[model samples]
Target: MKQSPAPSLPSAEAALPRLPDRRQSVQSAQTGMVVLKGLANIGGNAGLTALAAHVGESPAKVHRYLVSLMQEGLVDQDPATQRYFLGPELIRIGLAAMRQAEPIRHAEPALIRLRESLEVTCFVAVMGNRGPTIMRIEEPGLPVTVNVRAGSVMSMLWSATGRVFLGLLDEASVRQMAESELAAATDDMRALLPSPDPIGTLQREVRAACCASVRDTYLRGISAVAAPVFDFTGRVCAVITALGASGGFDPSVDGRIAIAVCREAHATSLKLGCVGPPPAAG
Candidate 1:
């Protein structure tokens, strides 16, 4: 026994797997990121105490970091309200990002395909500051007569694209927009605005269907069918419209081009992450 003492076994701690050293991790970056994310979520102006609570940091600590953020132009404090807001840098970045977005960039090929297959004039319209404006256009080789260009603004009540946006906009907003149009209405447009009821009726119908149609509303003998395209935020990012002679294309909910346009719009919407019917058109 004295000559054969039992050999000692390795300890349990030595039997465990090794974890890589994390000494290179930057704690300051972690704090800065946390603070920035918190500020973004808070949105608008926030005071020191309010922001501190929102970010789960002490007021003094948050203030110190905010000062650093201000130096980088990532934050701005109001001299009057003593509230902090996201700075001009974020605005500049956001505007730049939006300029590059071109929501209908990938949708052009689909528009071309639809036009070629349907033999109808097709276009994408997005809500603009003035109203629903055509962003892109695709036409069949044949002589079509609707007279709309890429910059053309459509009637919020008369055109299919316009109706879709009207359906998506709130009542007050629609009323205000309608009033503005009415103030500048020509004799022809005055005829269109006999009363808001007609436009209201169209808005209700479009909202119910998430689609709309126009026959001789914008142009006599011209008919159009439009379907709403939704984006990730559930807003109607764009409207796809198919147009041709009144007799050539059907504008009903179950019409030929209506079905096709809706299908194309649905496919486009899916690409942009829409899961349900469009919620907004802006």
Candidate 2:
């Protein structure tokens, strides 16, 4: 009898066991996670019946998972209400995840994607000692002509990137920087700002839009859209910006470029362990 043909490379690889496959998952552990997620989804404090309904499991089975999770310290129950809540161990794990989050590192890949997909210049800016400063820049094949580069300090009152930091952060120092910029600006430059309460207006508009867009404000002939990248603490740690020549760029807050920028910023914020809604382009 002819021997069976040797296994192909793909077949050989497939024969090896891989982790994270459903077949490799411990059933008990998967059930426990489902129960935990159900608890979290029901506002993190729910009765057995609600959790059971949420997970589409019998109360008895979900209870068994809950008991295992309790032993693992992943869940807890209130003595008075007999309701399940996310346990101290979950908080500890969350804190650990937050501690490892780095804003710039998480945002760099997003910038590159935005540059490639949208064909616009993109950058990540962090609030530096001087002001909002560019940390990384990603330019398209034909780069837009702008004065800013990596490490360049943006004008807190002028640039879309700087305005995003100013709008989200409630820091006295940041406000002071904006004030100083406003105070030192010439009549021509000051005219570019919103009338009758520029800072207040800027903050309101940015907060409402969940991002900032500028047309010929910071750099003449250059338009930009910027969105905030938040940390787990909900603080705006950095801003992601995309800019292009005004002739070709749409600077509307609700335009495609703004939406893409906000989506990337929201994704970066998620990688930084931030728990919040996506930036809505208003």
What C-alpha lDDT values do all the predictions have? Answer: 0.78, 0.90
Cα lDDT tens digits for candidate 1, 72-112:
88889999999999889877875675555455885787789
TM-score of each: 0.59, 0.85
Query: Model 2, range 186-212, lDDT digits (tens) per residue?
Result: 999999999899999999988898899
Instruction: Name the regions of candidate 1 deviating beyond 4 angstroms.
Output: 1-101, 171-174, 182-196, 277-282
Worst 10 residues of 1 by lDDT: 273-282
Report lDDT (Cα) of residue 273, candidate 2.
70
Instruction: Give the deviation of candidate 2 from the true structure as CA RMSD.
Output: 7.8
Give RMSD to native, each candidate.
10.0, 7.8
